[model samples]
Target: LAKTTQPISMDSYEGQEVNITCSHNNIATNDYITWYQQFPSQGPRFIIQGYKTKVTNEVASLFIPADRKSSTLSLPRVSLSDTAVYYCLVGERGQGGYNKLIFGAGTRLAVHP
Candidate 1:
């Protein structure tokens, strides 16, 4: 498994965009970097993923440098509803396809009025 480091908290007001970056210095060969978003009292939901380069979806864009050591998640036109803790996880976590070794301590995101 690869260890990850991310901000403990972030502050954002309404109508602004937020981008969070996570680093995994010792990322494994078979592992991939994935990002998740969580609202208060709710489980984290998948946002985007990438092994290298750029990946975009309805919610956010994932930018991974060629080094494959770190990645950034970009959320566009963020709203109060979008203000929430974001997490970056490496390794299978079972890939939602197998048994998972659960690890939790998700960052807290505060959305100011």
Candidate 2:
């Protein structure tokens, strides 16, 4: 599993674009990058996933460099409701052919009025 590091917290005003970056120094070739968002008292919700290059959906966009050692989650025009902890994860196969995703402490985004 690759170790990921992200900012502990970030501040954004409403209607502003916010970007959170994560670094994984030991990423592997077969690993897929995934991002999740979790609100208070709720489970983490899938935001985006990518292998390389950029991927975008209605909710957010994910960018992965060619080296696969880093990724960024970009949220456009965030609102106060979008405030949450964003997780960056890497998926790999564990022992016994089981797939596993490892998560670290996520970056907390505070969307202000």
Candidate 3:
């Protein structure tokens, strides 16, 4: 299993883009990088997932290098409502659910007006 590390906090203003990066030094061949976001009093929600290279969705984009040692979650034109605690996780999905998923301390993103 790979240990992940991320910044303790970040600050951004509305309409600006924010990129939170996580580093996983020992990522395994089968391990996949996933990002989650949690709002006040709400469970963490899925944001994006990637193995290598780049993956994009309606909400955000995830970029992974060929080495697969790190990943960046790019939020475009963030808004105040997007303020939340972002979690970077690494694991694989099993028949039951996510297996052996290791979560980091998380990055608290403060979106200013």
Candidate 4:
């Protein structure tokens, strides 16, 4: 598993774009970058996942460079409700084997009024 590095916390105002970057220098070739968002008292939910290049969905966009060593999760026009802890995870899906995703300390995002 690749270790992730992210900020301990971030501050943002409502209606602003928030981008969080995670680094994984020892990322494996079979590994994929996945982001999850967790609200208070709730479990983490999948935001986006990408192997290389870019991936977009209704909630967020994931950007991965050619090297696949790092990735960025982009949130557009965030609101106060978007305030949560974001996690960057690197792992491969199991193929007839038990595959587990390891989560590092997540980045806490604070959305202000």
Which candidate gets the maximum lDDT versus the true structure?
Answer: 4
lDDT of 4 by residue, 1-113 (tens): 88989888999999999999999999999988989999999999988999999999999999999998889999999999999999999999778996688888899999999
Return the TM-score for each candidate structure.
0.85, 0.93, 0.94, 0.96
List, residue by residue over 17-101, the lDDT tens digit for candidate 3: 9999999989888888999999999989999989899999999999999998899999999999999999998877665764777
Candidate 3: clashing pairs of residues:
none
The numbered model that scores best in TM-score is 4
Worst 10 residues of 4 by lDDT: 93-102
Residue pairs with colliding backbones in model 1 are: none
What is the TM-score (0 to 1) of candidate 2?
A: 0.93
Q: Residue 76, candidate 3: how far off, in angstroms?
A: 0.2
Q: Write the residue-wise lDDT of candidate 1 on 33-99 in tens digits.
A: 8888888798778888788899999999999898878888888877778877888888754655873
Assess candidate 4 and give its TM-score to the true structure.
0.96
Could you give candidate 2's per-residue lDDT for residues 1-113 as a string of tens digits?
Answer: 88899999999999999999999989888888889999999999999989899999999999998888899999999999999999999876456797677778899999999
- Model 4 local distance difference test score: 0.93
RMSD of each: 2.4, 1.8, 1.3, 0.8
